[model samples]
Target chain A: EAEVAQSPRYKITEKSQAVAFWCDPISGHATLYWYRQILGQGPELLVQFQDESVVDDSQLPKDRFSAERLKGVDSTLKIQPAELGDSAMYLCASRPPGSGIGTGELFFGEGSRLTVL
Target chain B: SQKIEQNSEALNIQEGKTATLTCNYTNYSPAYLQWYRQDPGRGPVFLLLIRENEKEKRKERLKVTFDTTLKQSLFHITASQPADSATYLCALDKGSGNTPLVFGKGTRLSVIA
Candidate 1:
C-alpha cells in the first residue's frame, strides 16, 4: 500500500538548537498536513499544504517554526532554538484530491519524534 | 474555539468483549467524523468515517455511529482481541468539506486475555 514517508523517526536535541523533520506524502495526494502530538494530547494541525502552496498555518508558531512543501509532494518542518516544551511527535498526513473516492480520509506517516533536552 | 473531547481515562476490557469509545465536540459541527487507531510511537491509522447524514457505518468487527444532534460519535470494536488494544482517536474535517482534520486526545483501550 502506498504510504506517507517521514524521516528521522527519533531525534533528540538540546534546547536552543535547531531541528528539522521531513515528510513525503503518498503520490498524487494534493493535500498535505503537519501536526503536533503532545504526550497526552490530540494532534494539532500546524500547517496545511495544497500542491506546494500553504493554505492554512494559523496555528503554526512562525516566530520559531517554519514549514515548506517546495514541490507539493514532500514537505519539511523546521524549528530553531528548540524549547523543552517543543518535545512532541511530528506527524505528516495526506489525502487524495476532492475527486478521489476517500474524500475525507487521511493517510498518516509513522511520524518523527523529537525530544529537547 | 472548536474542541473535541474523548475520555482521558483508560478502558480495560477482556478479549472477545465489546469496547466502546466516545467522542464529543463543541463550537462547530463536523460534516464527517472519522476514527483512527494509534499504537505507542506510531501515527494514527484510519479506521472508519461517518458522515453527518449517516447514522451508522460498519466495517468488519468495527462499527461507528455519528449523532449530529447530540454532537457526539461512538466507536465500537466487537470481539476484541489483545491486538485491538491501542489509543483510538476521533477526528473531524476542519468543519469545511476539504481541510485538515482536527483530532481529539483519544481514549486508550487495554484488552486483556
Candidate 2:
C-alpha cells in the first residue's frame, strides 16, 4: 500500500523563529492538504492544493504561514516567526483524482510535530 | 456557525465488549461522514465512510451508520481489544466540489484487557 510521507517528525523552536515541514503524497494523487491539529482538538484545514494550484486557503494565516505544492506531488508548509500557540501537529493528506470528488477518503502521513518555546 | 460534537472526551470499556462513539453536527448537512483513528502523537488514519444515502457500512469488526435526518453518525467497534484504544474522530464533507472535510474533536477510547 502506498503511503504519504512526511519529514521532520518532530521539531522544536523558540518563538519568533522559523519552522518548516515537508510532505510527499501518494503517487498519482492530485489533491493534497495541510492541516494543523492542536492538542485535544480536531485537525483544521490550513491549505488545499489541486495539481499545484491552490483550491482553498481561507483558514490559513497568510501573515505568518505559507504552503506550496510546487510539483503537485510533494508539499512544504512554513511558518515564520512561530508563536507559542502554533505548537501542534502538522498533518499532510492526499486524495486520488476522480476518487469521489469531495467525498473521497484521505490518506494521511505520520505527521510533523512542532513545539514552540 | 457549524459545529461538530462528540458524545464525550473519553470512554472506558472492557476487552471483548462493544464500544460505541457518537458524533453530532449542527448548522450543516453533510453528504458523507467518515471515521478515523489516531494514536497519540500521530496523524489520523481513515477507518470507515458512510454516505448520506447509505444507512450503514461495515468493515470487519468496525461499523458505521450515517443519519442525515438526525445529523448524526455512530461508530462502533465490536470485540474490542487493548490495541483498539485510541482517539476516534468523525469527519464530515458537504459533498460539494473541492470541499474540505470538517472534523470533530474526537472521543478517546480505552479498551482495557
Top candidate (TM-score): 2
- Across A7-71, the per-residue lDDT of candidate 1 in tens digits comes to 99999999999999999999998889999999978899999998999999999999999999987
DockQ of each model vs. true complex: 0.62, 0.68
lDDT of candidate 2 at residue A36, scale 0 to 100:
95
- Model 2 RMSD in angstroms: 1.0
Off by over 4 Å in 2: A101-103
Which window of 10 residues has the lowest lDDT sum in candidate 1 chain B? Answer: B92-101
| Pairs with steric clashes in candidate 1 | none
Error of 2 at A36 (Å): 0.3
Predicted structure with the largest DockQ when compared to the true one: 2
lDDT of 2 by residue, A16-105 (tens): 999999999999999899999999999999999998999999999999999998877899999998999999999999987775554588
Best of the candidates, lDDT: 2
